[model samples]
Target chain A: MTTTAINTKQFMTSEQLLEHWQGHRNLTRRVIEAFPEKELFEFSVGGMRPFAKLAVELISIGGPALKGIVEKKMDAHDEESFNPKTKAELLNKWDEETEVINRYFGQISEERFQETFNLFGQYEFPVYQNILYFVDNEIHHRGQGYVYLRALGMEPPFFWERF
Target chain B: MTTTAINTKQFMTSEQLLEHWQGHRNLTRRVIEAFPEKELFEFSVGGMRPFAKLAVELISIGGPALKGIVEKKMDAHDEESFNPKTKAELLNKWDEETEVINRYFGQISEERFQETFNLFGQYEFPVYQNILYFVDNEIHHRGQGYVYLRALGMEPPFFWERF
Candidate 1:
């Protein structure tokens, strides 16, 4: 850690990262909800990944990574992440994972934000960037979700209204 | 400038933010380029904003917001943002604003990251948060772009490949 004269209190508050991340999570949950059952799992444009598969990827990352962060575990993340059978099961897992995120977010100390923890023992960045990857990956997949929804002749939830 | 013991030097670097943001911009620009010329401005789902309007809104936010951040000149942002009658015109405008973003991002300093600045003479926050709003808004709009692209039977660029 470079101890420069400048302080790092506001580089990113835990609250800010949490809220920013949760906001994306909330929007993604809505995106999942908007899809028809069959289309949610099957719809794709030009042979791209389906929304169900993408949502499963997000489910795999969020809750498990939070546990690893708090418990100092570097468990391998290459398992077949999530394979929920139905849309209802997917939503349940997403909710369960959201709770996991909230709980683990509470366990993080301000000092932990600065510590170097090897994420899954592969990506070696600070905790902040790791958390951001969660959001960035979600946004990328959710963009695919939007594509799927529009292809199915359905309107997605407004992008600006995330609570 | 809260100077504390644990240093937060690597929470985010200027280069990281630029690379991350520029990657998103490249993907969004490609999304714009993928649209059929007639549909780029006209298509919509259930009366929500069109992709073209959303693209206009992004154009308004990105370059103008960067100018505000680096130059400390908070220009009003409520006029007609971009009115390209042709897809070629819109692409030209996107390239122009991207250049503006590159020029302005160079002007920001590490110290400027810590300062609290009101974005567009409203939405006051730290400069980093403001910069993030630009990226967040773009992602949100670009999701719409993806939807539009799929509706047109076109494929958007892979989200993670740009870097």
Candidate 2:
């Protein structure tokens, strides 16, 4: 294998990491799917932020950050804004962004792994750190998803496997 | 606050991020706490992996990743050999890692944000991507955390807000 290909293979071979990412996204979709349209924005824990807001934040973070990576521009403020009033709308946007993530991820060159870029024009960090941040940010909010699921007494997807 | 401080406040602010991170760990801990010890290791979703294995993965990801960031070493493969035996042990380790993250984050200067680093010695992603991955990975698994919580009839943390 070429050196770049070999390196990619070694990193991409992390089944757990891949599974973890896909699984979490799948689960987040499920949680959104499970919520009643009204509850999406109203649900909270102790006057905390609403799941809807958090979802928007997640969507906002991914595409814009990727854009920042691609364009090598730092967003000084909230980069992308999508306000979906209904569950269907949010899901559609979610799916669209998911595709964006996959497409962007596919475009990542091994040579650019160490490249530094600014996200939101505020923090100048490396490309890898931002990517991990995207995944980590998603998982963090998805934890909230679990709470919402439990509150609704709805059975969420099985946690053991990501399919 | 000065303009620069104001401009960079969001990126420099680790409080919300840390809250999200800690909140996730706490929720995941709850998932494990709710499960019967025997089932912790045996429970599977759709013939997939068990929650216990997933937890181990979470613990393994955090410490070494943070260490990598602090030390500015990208090719750290120390995560491969980490395996914690008990829930308490993992929790203790997690607590320590949380502190580590806080300390490391505090020490990072705004000027140094763009430094590049490798993750797992494979991806040539930047330092930003690495940090993002650290948090994103946690969120992914934490989604499973919701599943586990639901299965156990326990309420996970609220999805919308960090407390």
Candidate 3:
């Protein structure tokens, strides 16, 4: 059988993928909430960027990438644009972006997932792969936040409890 | 349209999923290789488990879970079964398990991805979700390893360079 024939069966619906991504996002938001303001901004092990900075990087990517995908715009990637001076401000932007994600994500039809889209004018891949990268990148960074929390003698939300 | 109808288009092929997962495994192996022998087992921040122990947890999960799925076995989850004293020994077992993953992963029919499998007599999820958990869990721990390496003044493999 041809590759296309064998792959005709769905691995997941667009809605299921959105739910999965949002679940991870919810868990990440909790990780951000677990930190004290000082540690979120200043704590680091071995000079790695602080958890707050990591959160900023994620915030920069998700909504912007989805907007780019839907709009077919390859704007240059910008990680420095959104600077949250406090945890509360950061959380507000995060909550707002979640809505941005929901809106742009809904605009992607099933057929669009298989089409290649150059993400942020770089890293060209199928739309689904780009979306997977967003989720994967979040998990990787949240993993770092988990370590930071542990090192601070604080408990992070369970990794599996992505609601 | 019914959810099933909307989902008829493929999100990814089984082989593509395997490739994506193995890319992660390859990067994780690099993380293991970066650690000093003593630190791999004994290093910690805030009493978190060392990278070696985290690696052991992953080693215990992936191949065994696939075996359980292919053979219809639900053996109790065991993280303490394989203890590696040295980095060499750990990498050896990692290589063996990679082959084991390749072998057993091949036996799972595409249709089986949707079937519910109670993994390790613990988490009951669709086989694909269980597999994803394995990958997600690996990335999570590896993220910790990245932090540990940074703290130790060592550089981890780039998160994006999985291959």
Candidate 4:
């Protein structure tokens, strides 16, 4: 009898993907909560960017890019149209997008992960590359949040042990 | 009539700092919400480290370092206990630390931000440098989140336009 090779091409099960995504999001959320409202916007280190701008960037990118992935469409331009005047408003938007992401994730099929797509009309990469990009981006920004937290003399959330 | 010069240092009041911090936190929470739970602990990009490990490092450095800044005390061996088990538990701890940060920020005087402090018994940096680290670290992680979000076919939050 011949043994069949295991199919490594199978994408992550929806359950697995969702779990990892949520875990990362939760960690990022903790970092945000650790900050005081004042430092979130005006605080800076060594002429670097402020925490608020960085947060805006995260919002602008995460929502639309994910939407594009689900729809199988590539955005020709970067994200625009971010307008939150207060911390409350930002939180409200954050809550709204959380639901949006879940809905989008629900629609993904395993076969879709194997399909290749164009990101920002720049690179022709596999779906896996795009997925990796999502995780990488979040980690990058979270690192910035760590810096801000330290500057303010406040503890941030732990990085390891997210299940 | 002589015009009085406004102190640039005084402009960044504690209230403003708090708002900024809160806004940053809210945005980060959205990033966490972008992903599923399991990936939070297991996902990795290239040969790079997992986001979970990074979160642990953040937690370890963030709290004690902040305390050191506020108390004007520094210890070299503070980066040892940066481990956790589950994503939910990590998030819970993140929430707790947020409260501590708020309390610490509330006590900050404008004079204190300019005061210098030592970090990890190795680097002698100003309070501002330490504060900036928190925000910077967040950005770094969030960048990774962005990559993950892209891969997951979900959009990340905007980098700018945080209120």
Q: Which candidate leads in DockQ? A: 3
lDDT of 3 by residue, B30-140 (tens): 999999999999997878999999999999999999999999899998998798999999999999999999889877887788899898888899888888889889988
lDDT of 4 by residue, A23-42 (tens): 67777666666777777777
Each prediction's total of clashing residue pairs, residues at least 3 apart in sequence or on different chains, is 0, 35, 1, 149
Per-prediction RMSD in angstroms?
Answer: 5.1, 12.6, 1.9, 21.6
Stronger candidate by TM-score (1 vs 2): 1
Best by TM-score: 3
Candidate 4 local lDDT, B1-163, one digit each (tens): 1112111212223453455555565666566655667776676544344566655665666566667667767677444565656777767766677777776665555556566667777656556546645654665666655555554566677854244
My TM-score estimates for the predictions, one after another, are 0.71, 0.51, 0.94, 0.48
Residue B24's lDDT within candidate 4 is 60
DockQ of 4: 0.07
Candidate 4 chain B superposition, TM-score: 0.80
Score candidate 1 by TM-score against the native: 0.71
Question: Which segments of model 3 are wrong by more than 4 Å?
Answer: A2-10, B2-9
Model 1 / residue B39 / CA error / Å:
3.1
Winner on TM-score between 3 and 4 is 3
- Which parts of model 4 have CA positions greater than 4 angstroms off? A1-12, A161-163, B1-163
| lDDT by residue (tens digit), candidate 1, A20-113 | 7888888999998888898888878656678888888888888888789899999977538468879999999899888899888767776675
TM-score of 4: 0.48
Candidate ranking under TM-score, highest first, comes to 3, 1, 2, 4
lDDT string, candidate 2, A78-158, tens digits: 725577788898889888987777556544454454567777877575665566567666766776665665666666565
